[model samples]
Target: MKVKNIVRTVAAVAAGAMLIPLAACGGGTAADSGKTKITFLSWDNEQTMSPFIEEFEKENPDISIDFSYAPPTAEYIQTLQTRLVGNQAPDVFIITSENKNDLIDNGYVLDMTGKSYTEKLSQANKDFVSRDGKVYGQSISSWAAGIAYNKELLKQVGYDTVPSTWDEFLDLCKKLQDNGVSPYIEAIGDGADRIPDSFTGAILADKGIDVTTLASKDPQTPGANEKEAVKAWMKVYDEGYASRDNVGVSGDDAKTQFVNGQVAMYCTGAWDFSTFEQAGFDWGFAQIPALDKNHEQYAQGSPSPGLAIYSKLDGDKLKAAEKFLDFMVSDWSLEQRSKNGDAITVDGFESDVTEQYKDVYENNLKTGKYFLMTNFYSNPDVLISTNNAEVQQLVQGSITADQWAENIDAKMASAQ
Candidate 1:
């Protein structure tokens, strides 16, 4: 919602203040030259979403989409929040881990609980945007983050593929380090650390702990299981398998190290494919090793943010918004999304992911063997920021793994 200040004359200014909205004016269902206009605020840029919008418009000639964009994460959240608070929100917008609670508690997004289009979503995709058995968003894809190891580097260490268990993985790291290779590097400078997150998933699965149930507990104790996971993950630093300096490394820095052959493995995901492909080396991606031989392999990931209809939308405009969501799950949209490199998770649709990432695609994404701490915890933004700071201290040996977990609990309790 753009507000323009117009002061053409002193007399007009003295009379009253007049504000006019610009191109970003379509808040709800507005008639655009006799056609119902459904406003949509997209996290994706126009280039990525335009083709679908055009196709949808062509399919339903009576409904026009007043599409707008804000880049993801911070800017997108702020833009949506501002619009929602100002009572000028779009008919449709994104629902993500960062804003799901607020959106639901405030009755901002419509429940897609019994919507036919929702029936086509994968269970994991449905659960990601769901709260208390009611679905709110149409999430259609997921991404997994795990170990990306250099094939040649691992070959030098006499390993054909990444091991499936944590102990063996550490042994391999030891071998790589003994051979003068920097063993492993994962960025812990921001967000929740992926290594620990994967370990937490494995632990949770082994213990049969339901994430949703854990999420419902008090915020102070929500991350209780994370203690064991963090303790296991700390072995990398405790045993000197990974560099303590990695606490300061950014994701790009870790990727750069791997690309430069300075590190044997980097903890990342498919987003690094193009850069890895251009690095002139044979690289392979694999799910993060299980917590132990008894545990299932898991990766750190979550479904992409989902599109949700505004709860206030009704009448022809609401119908138009629903149609737009239905089109997203249509065969054409799935195929296009697959082509665009999303690991499409809509039911009956298989993404043709690249071969290097096939391990993660098959083992983690397909089976829902992935976890994200922020996705399951309360005050997600606070959880991530606090976890990042606490984990950095754990890496620096300034605090024990147990202390890290305790700190996380205390921080979350205080935040609540």
Candidate 2:
């Protein structure tokens, strides 16, 4: 109990102070037996990511990945935002369409400006997660929503394949109905407000006029292109091509109908390939049959977001985090993703996707007929629930297509 004892205590406290900078899970990386530890938060469920994480850990034994998840869309974004603002976000996580810009603007996303991994990324991916060439995300895949068909159903209607052209598509729809099969079905559930809008957009894009390139903010108010596009979209419902039941349906319900043989075709994204694989029938993918022969195929699409780092990360930990991103786009990861029905899309990354989405990968993406709604208009909300309501009314005959166009312009104006 003398000065010597006090000095010893002081030295111990100072040594602990030197290691005060905290790491993940309330401890430093050194706590895990000298392995640099990093956390990865994802929108994907644990079941989907568990096996991948095990492989990643096996390949890089020096770095341990602590995976966490939240349901996609709103729940995921909200959880990530709350944690990041509280200075407790994961070392790496997904940068979704909803949270990408906000994360970048706040300087929360790391700038992999000169990293070798940034060199061979796709333009669509780069542009989405970058501001003026500073990359903040690693793109793993690109997705497009288009026409999916049941091959066997078409044969019963005297066709080997669905037709490509507005008139022919409609005629084919009629034939299927006459044969007691529902020709087409769409799930207009909330954010799934894309089917009709995609049709309208394709009609516009076919004529070399897209909403992104419009001379007027409200194309419908400015020219015949918008009006014609609306009419084309409405014609499907007006003439009973896609049944009215679509309005009451959700994506899962519509998919169920298609799988059960109640419908001949589905208008959806490639994400549905997994579910359709169990349909117990032959099926194939098709580009939204060129709006008509004159116009090439047009579909809705976007580059999928990827693993991003916290801007403040550095040292061996930062290096380890980069390794995870590299692994995400590596041939191994892409192959794993492709096997699960994803279309791999990193610039230099290649993997074999299922044949059902071959048309989307080979033809549609190359020709630029695939457009993300973000390119056309960035609405205030991600779901577009209001737009869905208006479209529902329009399809129900309570409103005209012109009124539908007006409602969207109003929403656009309100958002602006």
**Model 1: per-residue Cα lDDT at residue 253:** 88
* lDDT score for candidate 2 against the true structure: 0.67
Backbone clashes under 3 angstroms, per model: 0, 0
Over the stretch 1-416, how does candidate 2's per-residue lDDT look in tens digits? 00000000123333334233322231245545868788877867677777677787789877787777665555566667767887887899888556766787789989987676666676556655666557788876677777788889999989887677767888989998889888888786533544444455566665555343332254223213344555776667888878776778888898898888888888887667778887677888787766566666666676676678999999998998888877776677778887775666666555576777777776655334565544333332522455567767876788887776677666565554
- Local accuracy of candidate 1 as per-residue lDDT tens digits, 1-416: 00111111223332222112223433245455778888888878778888998899889878888777765666567677778988988899999888888899899999999898898887777888888889999988998887899999999979988899999999999999999999999877644378777888777777787776655776546457688888888898899988888888887888899999999998888878899999888989888999887788999888888999999999998999999999999999999988887898776788998898888888888788888777876677777777777878888999997788788888888988
In candidate 2 the C-alpha lDDT for residue 9 amounts to 19
lDDT of each: 0.81, 0.67
Top candidate when judged by lDDT against the true structure? 1
- Shift of residue 33 alpha carbon in model 2, Å: 4.5
Displacement of the residue 380 alpha carbon in candidate 1, Å = 1.1
Worst lDDT run of 10 residues, candidate 1, spans: 1-10
Q: Give the runs in model 2 whose Cα sits over 4 Å from its true position.
A: 1-35, 50-62, 131-134, 177-181, 189-193, 196-228, 270-279, 348-350, 365-369, 374-383
